[model samples]
Target: MGFLNAVGNVGLALSVAQVATASFYIYLEWYAHGKWTGHPGMQEMKKIAENISSSSFSTASTSSDELEFLRSHPSPEGVASSIDKEFRRMEKFVAFAGRGLTSSWSGRRIVVTPSWILFSHRTTFLPICQLLGHLGAVVVGTRCINNQIASLGEDEEQERADPMLGSGVVMATIRIADMDSGACMLSFDLPASELENFRLYLCCPLVYAQGVSLEPSIIQRFLEAFSAVVQENEPIEIPPSMELERCIGCLSNQTSVAIRRSCAGECGSCRCRPMWCEMCVGRWFASRLAQSHVPTSEWVASRVPCPTCRSLFCVRDVISLKRAQY
Candidate 1:
């Protein structure tokens, strides 16, 4: 479930980032074309400029229609071509920013580009970084790297030897600051593969967590706590019955069954079968909810109703069956 949520967020971030990049360029184009004349401040500035020019030389006053023409007409061909080139460059830059998350780059030193630094202020960018960090990438902010380099001195070699650096690693350098001192924090390298399952430290939105301390010990504790919570909440597996080939809900001979109702009481008066693959059951549940006029918040009150008998079942009544063969 957590993995799915992370994947969904990544897709969403990519979409939003693309739209924002396009909007930014569109605004720049508008500014360059004098479309900003619609603003009262711009009109005042234009009047001042005209007065200064008229006093020096008897020039014909520009008309509102002329101003409107300037705003609507395209700039010179050279200027239009230049803006088109810039648009392409901006697209490439946006793609490069998201490359770390969508593609694997092993053994490469990922530097924070100026474009990324500028866009990092957007809310979408941080989540993309956080998701990548959670997926075993080592993110080193710009401030932290500067601080670490400044303090190198005699410990430079020692820092290099720190077990964190390893081959085929995805390392990211960012800019983060210390909460209390407002000073840039120190940076460190890490083996990306080793941190694949390390969620706690990466899930905290470290990029934006100005209030939280970034000390190694504190980060270690956070990881430990997250691991404990995950372990405690892990669902127990139940042995499958002989009738696993057929879905209890639709009696369909699907190859994979995602959910199994092990508890009899939860079925209540429902005559529908208990075994169900995600697709079949999910559609039924969604359709049932869609037909109702209830608010989304209240839909959960209905629980997961059995498609056949309309009996409600709590989430605990069902267990997800793994498709993997032990």
Candidate 2:
């Protein structure tokens, strides 16, 4: 009976110790938040924002591409202004131009401006992190098959049915790494047609093309074959009567490629007229290779079907169409 009582006391002591440790951790977190020191926790983020806003303001004041809002829109005279107050500009960019990817229900919602990128939790909408700039960007996943959204309203249904749906330029995960280090600081899925938006603001090099999309992509030169095929194929002149239409793949760029079999292989020829742009078709080829579960080395030798006609053709078969002289 005494031994059992002693064991109970030991258990009580361990529980007390755990509670004390937990309290110490909570105290440390509170201190890390700068509540005790009376200093801002986000000093570095604030400074980065300030620097970007000041630089943008100065450039707008000097350049021909000056924003009209800075002049007509009034702020307090002699008071330093911050771009954070350009709420309308930021909102407009988000609504109309669509700068970044976001989620409504859960996970992080991101917003990117020329000045800074903010990631906030969907629940509370409080910022998770703010990035002023990035070193380089890389995209990973199946992108060879570009899936144009059939209906914007049915996007949710489509995603649920086929998780591999590739909408817009890329249906892939994008990871942004720090300038000073290769460690990924931000990772997000690029929304449909938002790839160009990322390019416009961030202007970061595709680490994938630099052979750094994956750790193995560097040694394997994963993107080299796909890139080479597109660059090497000479442009085909379009007939004067043939109208240049919007690319079926991106629904944005003009259709500039036709799948004309120019290779010496067993691959079938495509009868379809130019329906995809150079970039989109290349992406389609890459997507096929990605889905094949084959090594990147074999991708260049593989054949892909035309998005419309379904006729199989090698990468070399994609020829850019030169707009007729009008």
- The candidate that achieves the highest lDDT relative to the unseen native structure: 2
Best by TM-score: 2
In order, what lDDT does every prediction score? 0.36, 0.51
- Candidate 1's C-alpha lDDT? 0.36
RMSD list, candidates in order: 25.2, 15.4
Report clash pairs, candidate 1. Answer: 140-172, 140-173, 140-174, 141-174, 141-175, 142-174, 142-175, 248-273, 248-275
In angstroms, give how far residue 224 of model 1 lies from its true place. Answer: 28
lDDT of 2: 0.51
Prediction-by-prediction clash tally:
9, 3
TM-score of each: 0.21, 0.36
lDDT of 1 by residue, 111-149 (tens): 222111112222211211111111122244222221131
What would the TM-score be for candidate 2 when compared with the true structure? 0.36
Judge candidate 1 at residue 222 and give its lDDT: 34
Candidate 1 Cα deviation (angstroms), residue 140: 46
